[model samples]
Target: GLKGPENWGMIEELASVLGAATACSKPVSDIGWRPHSEHVGQTGKPVAANLYIAVGISGAIQHIAGINSSKVKVVINNDPEAPFFKVADYGIVGDAFDVVPRLIEKLKEFKANNA
Candidate 1:
């Protein structure tokens, strides 16, 4: 779970580098893993970012409803059958531990080269 302190720093770093807002699923918020202010779903905050990336989320109907307005949706989940993939413009079926670090590296490289 992303509630782990070890993973939280990486998530925050990635979001900071991407200049993106961070949000959490209802379950995460309800469980007190994340603050309710960051919750994104039918019962929480709505998201309409140009690019929405869902990592490790199962994409419940309420979650989908909140993020459906995003111009592009990217889903990364280890489960190939995760519902998030059905609505995603790009899908990566892999462990977040393996995928996120590589993604962060690539994004950093891109930023460095483009900057």
Candidate 2:
């Protein structure tokens, strides 16, 4: 999967940090940058994640259907009413670019302390 090379390091770190695999939405995967296996959608691969975090995604009905079964759904988008919030167990209505980094930092800090 090649959504972007920028996040692979972080993904690798976090996967180890949380014991999770990396996945992306069809819209991002369709760009040919990401592998088909990375697609998560009603028409694509179905997922039942323990913690599904959607950042910068609009969370369309089609997309949500695939992820709705997750034990925890967290959405971060600038739009106050991105519609994803309705299905999310927790949501942050803000710029994902800003929120994601902060979240990563916090998680890293917590991981460091816990370790």
Candidate 3:
């Protein structure tokens, strides 16, 4: 959400970078760029990914209800007290715009090293 139209393209790019399947909050699916099958929210599909990275998404109890079973829950939010942090295995208190780019860079590094 932080990025402009051009950078929004990066969200798709990042999906490949992370080897992550794209999932979204309800609003994004309502607009229809992604399928409802990939939606993660109380009224949508539940995710059981090995890693769940939530950014800018506030942890409404409803959202938490969907993803609590993830093996590793990592939350990135500027607000330190966001409820998602309460259930997250790792929490990053920072702007997601900055953090996500750095995280993508680091993940690329991680993949390179592991490969």
Give the alpha carbon lDDT tens digit for every residue of 1-86 in model 2: 22365754655555566778877778777876468888898988888999988876788888998888899998878888788888
Instruction: Specify the poorest-scoring 10-residue window by lDDT in model 3.
Output: 1-10
Which consecutive 10 residues in model 2 have the weakest lDDT in total?
1-10
Residues 4-108, candidate 3, lDDT per residue (tens digit)? 334455566567898787677776666765577867878988888898888776788877888878899988889998988899999999997788888888889
What lDDT is reached at residue 61 by model 1?
95
What lDDT would candidate 3 get against the real structure? 0.79
Error of 3 at 2 (Å): 4.0
In candidate 1, list every pair of residues with a backbone clash. none
Candidate 1 residue lDDT tens string, 15-51: 8889997898999888777799999999998899999
Q: Candidates' lDDT values, in order?
A: 0.87, 0.77, 0.79
Task: List ranges where model 1 is wrong by over 4 Å.
Answer: 1-5
Q: Give the better candidate number (1 or 3) by lDDT.
A: 1
| Candidate 2 Cα misplacement greater than 4 A, ranges | 1-16
RMSD of each: 1.2, 2.9, 2.2
**Rank list by TM-score:** 1, 2, 3
